[model samples]
Target chain A: MSILDYILGSRKKTANVAKDRLKLILAHEREEGGPDYLPALQEELLTVIAKYIPVDKNNIKVSMERKGDFEVLELNILFPDQH
Target chain B: MSILDYILGSRKKTANVAKDRLKLILAHEREEGGPDYLPALQEELLTVIAKYIPVDKNNIKVSMERKGDFEVLELNILFPDQH
Candidate 1:
């Protein structure tokens, strides 16, 4: 079953609910790739994710690094208290 | 700047930091799409997102639905308390 099927099929059982987590890393575009590509890709991913996940805008945690070829962007969302 | 740059570039300023949120949907694959494709795609996205976002696995909210030709899977992440 696909993720949708899994989620829907198991909705009646709280034990089957999947945890929510997301991570995205972006690298500087190669000379051939162009500098603008990475940023654009990241933006697209965020836009897509935002459209589906319901997050408290105020609680979002984002981190970034600019070390050498490894340009990384990390996002962490801490779910609220659960039963 | 790409998403990584945007997040990393804006790290120092809380206001500049992006909020954390994610959403994913899966549909029944068409004959051309293959029955397994939708599930696989959803799995791939979740795996990628999980690697980047830090969330309380227990609090993750997942919802699913199946209606005729449409099957939908939705994921929502709620961040913990923030300043």
Candidate 2:
């Protein structure tokens, strides 16, 4: 590839990264959580896992189905390769 | 302050920051948790709170005395000014 093509490709990548980050922020805000901070909690959790293993945030979901049992904190990050 | 004083003060601050961070890592590793990932869990949680306000990790502590009740997740960050 030409030098100009490489430069343009890198620029496109930066833009895409920014777009993806913004989209992620929006999605996190939009998601309804059992507690208001559940989304934040999950995001923070995924970061801790990232220190040990690479994970796809989109696929590795943390959901709480019922709150009766002292709150269910189900980290469905069992299948990292599913994504 | 003189330029040398300013520079020296800043250098000392940096050293303290590094020292504090290393001490934290060591403490986290040294502490025992029912689940091995408890330290990681707490650190990740504090980061979420930091998005909105400044926090002193040293002041805030997250600990679970007993885990018999569907796993207790206690976030002791209710007091931000304790530090």
Candidate 3:
């Protein structure tokens, strides 16, 4: 399929493509380090933060990006204001 | 300030905190790799894709994530339908 077709056609396939691409990039990134620790870190963060506030563990997103000279690890968590 | 305060305070400061946290995490990631080449890759991708279709260069985002045993490289580009 064409790039556009692949991007707009099946959502599952599109997601897979994105995931595959990210894997390659991350492999290169990890080479500079050893192994990814984000998963463990995310779990720890959730445990610690949930102790103080109600959070949606299922929706929490933790990722990383490179900006200029800095590498940025992004964290997004959803929690109800009333909770 | 408390974590909640930092998370909910001035937008600029909140952003700074997130950036700082990400920096620390990414520092560990980059230890596996020497240098990041994503910026260069993004530019090249823009040039190649722009040749085939009109796209918003400013909105294109290239990022990476680790999932299970795979590392995901995500590419997001916005283009007008008419173009």
Which candidate number would show the highest TM-score if scored against the true structure? 1
Ranking by lDDT: 1, 3, 2
For residues B1-83, could you state the per-residue lDDT of candidate 2 as single tens digits?
Answer: 32222223333343332111100110111112223444455566467556744467655444443222112233433223222
* TM-score of chain A in every predicted structure: 0.48, 0.39, 0.42
Docking class of 1: incorrect
Candidate 2, pairs of clashing residues: none
True contacts kept of each: 0.10, 0.06, 0.00
Which RMSD values do the candidates have, in order?
17.2, 21.2, 19.7
The parts of candidate 2 lying over 4 Å away from their true place are A1-41, A54-59, A64-76, A79-83, B1-35, B56-61, B65-73, B79-83
| Candidate achieving higher lDDT, 1 or 3 | 1
Q: Summarize candidate 3's per-residue lDDT along A1-83 as a digit string, tens digits.
A: 22222223323442432211211111111223333444454455445445544556565556655433333345544444341
- Rank all candidate structures by their TM-score, best first, as comma-separated numbers: 1, 2, 3
lDDT for position A66 in model 3:
48
Candidates sorted on DockQ, descending: 1, 2, 3
Clash number for model 1? Answer: 11
The CAPRI class of candidate 3 is incorrect
Candidate No. with top lDDT: 1
lDDT (10s digit) by residue, model 1, range A6-76: 43353336423334433333333122222333344455555555544545555456665555433554455
